[model samples]
Target chain A: MRRDRSIIKNEKSLRTYITPPADLYETPDAYILYIDLPGVTKENLNIKVVDNSLIVQGKFELSLPKDSDTMFSELAKGEYRREFVLAGDVDRNKIDAKLVNGVLILTLGKKEESKEIEIKIE
Target chain B: MTLVRWSPLRDLATEIFDLQREINKMFDRFFRGFEEEEEVRISTWSPRVDISETDDEYIVRAEIPGVSKDDVKVTIRDNVLTISGEKKQEKETKNENFHRIERVYGSFTRSFTLPGAVKVDKVEAKFKDGVLTIKLPKVEEAKTKEIEVKVG
Candidate 1:
């Protein structure tokens, strides 16, 4: 356990079994990443891309009483945070993000020159 | 002769308190209406467990899926069995996106007081496919045995 500035300098990956499955697909033009994120509203979600990295942040409101006795509670009350680094061939300006059914689907289009890669043996 | 004016602070506090109470009531109704409420997240998620008693030993099984074996810790001290663990989040791409997050994370601990005398020195624990099984063998005298009676 090592720390700097009272903050965890190195955070291990935060994996959750409840996270929606992600599907990656690539065509000649672009690549698509689909992730499921239920119980989240668009108003409470934020998506940002900075310096070749994409960040997704959203708070899950349990909306439960603090003192009330709960029969069962499965939905965790906290902000969901996830980040990903972009590849060199990714066209950041053309990236698109959409939230539907509590799932975040991101489409990263490839650069024009990289769309049709060529390999030749001299 | 001076006149004292009433402030709205008290009225505001009362209004806030009433709002809080109303919110609580609404949440109570919503929770009651939940059909498939399974496990609630408190400080940690502790699932219900079942224990079986046999002639040789006591078998305990706990339902804790998505939790790794390395995260679970089991110990017995003075006839008190304590199980504790923390489920660490998994690794993802630098820009991992999630749609629905429902899993519970954090440290969970459960303690059980042994009902019958048993051999603590030989307590064994095995974690397989998300289920933790513990076997506590009963001492020779603590085990129920059949006695033969020879009479005319």
Candidate 2:
């Protein structure tokens, strides 16, 4: 029966989607993002890149028994949506998305010209 | 003003209380700036859970993303249901440069006292997509019953 302030705040926004927590990492050639979306499956997940922004949306429904009453609740139900602004050097066409263990992994590859290359002197 | 006698014991108690308050304030100030970093180092986070009940059974669901099924454990004792698990971070990211990190990783435990007796042997649990669902069937005596009456 532990009550967290963030859970109570999320309950107030039940009608809207929750902003899932995320992590961002930068490698030599790509930027990777991981978003936690528990209970979301591949079928209900949507990812798209529009302009320079990457939008991610996922919906999950918990099916309960008929005529059931919720005794205690802290888990957020409904949709999850998050958007990130892509950098200018990111190659939109090379972006990849994967859903693994309820986490959405997005890899935004850098453009060919943006990647660092060793210069040779004669 | 009436003259009051000063007791050494009371004076010592007051001094100790003042010292305790000052120490607490100092610790608060010291930890306030590094709360996030401290959380990352400790890595203990509780997963959100939902519990529901119907006429015959109770259902519990917990959101534990990035945790493997083998890492989770469920148990019931003394009418208390407990779910515990550890969420491991990806190994490859250990040395990577992280631009931002908001997701939590570590062990967590949550327990709830059951409202009614349940058939402990009939409990079923399933894990999928990082959500753990538990179904606990209530005992025969604990099931709710509805009655209908005829109108005259």
Candidate 3:
């Protein structure tokens, strides 16, 4: 019986959450961050940047009608909250956020003073 | 969909996937409202709410599905209103293939700090259609009243 219980415990721990993949890339003008968040909606998401910290939050709603019963449940439902410390080069004022499909795209441009500019002489 | 040995459409598929993810995030944020990290939990989606004033009392509504009245716990502490509850999972399934499972379970705790004094003893909560509604009637002194205006 003890051996059987151990196997059940192992199986429960083996069931893990699939971490969504994200990518952060830099361009000449901006740093772009792409996050993959499947089975999510625009109505339950939030993004905020305070000083050097960037916080992203999202909730997945899973309510069914009154006479509904579940045959199976695989998708996990809860709030998604993640935070990141911003690099000094990121321009807090010029950051842009856009959501399409189930992914979140954030573009943080360089500070205004750091942009490359060419001098013109008449 | 057939895959060709050399197809530029592969890149198009990746772009479409990216766009879908972005749109999903936008919609999620619009409905979540403001939340603090302390509200974290394994499951249970608690929505942010705005409480309004009325002539008699204040109205508060919370979205808590799959939870019965007996599973919920309401308490008032230090002028903060707290609601905590659990939604137990249904009976186990023996054999079934699920394409999608999206309902949230487990427990959740949500608190709101009142701006004015509340008659805690008189507070009431009602659950209907997966929504939890609370009424916090104000005390006699806490009630808002219009005063006569005098020219300065």
Candidate 4:
């Protein structure tokens, strides 16, 4: 029921961009996002923030032997795309991204003024 | 209108019938080389795989992200190739407040029957970048041969 769009198709490339499964976690200092992108290398992954939206794109290469015929195919090869709208508290400049074991981990730090502050009473 | 009383035995029989139908549907999907999308979120999820056949060998590649190389197991028994593994969740995320969770975790197993005989001793499997590729060399008799005819 989330408002994010799932899949997008490129007209020129004729390649479909699937939305990879993701998990979002909120901590006191940052928001962490995990995206599963199997068979995608770090060089094939792209992440950028435009305005208040964070967009991620990845491509998976399927290498087959010469003169080979595919008998059964269930794995989707091509591209993966997903976009998330940033909240006001999220500091876009403090975002960190890393690829580990084919999973993309993104940490979006919270803004200075948005973090919880403890006040002492005299 | 006639009121019918609920019977426990009848209800049990209907439940068993539904279970049998579900199993049959699962087998049908397996033979068709397809899986339902909604099933990915279940506790036990199967990774997507691609099978290709060359002139000398059969290649199988499976997509299993976030799984360690040591957690995977590949075996060919009775001409059935099976790939089983576990995708463990990160322990650091346990304390964090989760907003949305769509990725699947836990153990998975996928099996496929080989169409031809292969050299089990020469099979090789490699895991890289969360994808496992297995190569099964075909036996001599199973390899395709080219024959030419000479006109008299």
CA error at residue A2 for candidate 4, angstroms: 27
* Cand. 1 TM to true fold: 0.40
Tell how far residue A62 is off in model 2, in angstroms.
1.6
Q: Pick the candidate with the highest TM-score.
A: 4
Which candidate leads in DockQ?
4
Q: In what order do the candidates fall by DockQ, top score first?
A: 4, 2, 1, 3
lDDT at position B1, candidate 3: 100
Error of 2 at B57 (Å): 0.5
What TM-scores do the predictions have? 0.40, 0.75, 0.40, 0.78
Candidate 2 docks at the CAPRI level of acceptable
Ranking of all predicted structures according to lDDT, beginning with the best and ending with the worst: 4, 2, 1, 3
Q: Give DockQ per model, in order.
A: 0.03, 0.41, 0.01, 0.56
Compose the digit string of candidate 3's lDDT tens values, residues B1-152: 98768767987998998998797677546434322234333445554344545656666655554466788787878777777888654423333322223445578877656656889889998765345667888888876689999999
Cα shift from native, residue B149, model 3 (Å): 2.3
Clashing pairs counted in every model? 17, 0, 29, 0
For model 2, how does the per-residue alpha-carbon lDDT over A15-112 read when each residue is reduced to its tens digit?
57799999999888999998999999999999998767898999988898789987667898779998899999999999998887788889999999
- Angstrom error of the Cα, residue B1, model 2: value is 21
Q: Is candidate 3 or candidate 4 better by DockQ?
A: 4
Fraction of native contacts (fnat) of each candidate: 0.01, 0.89, 0.00, 0.88
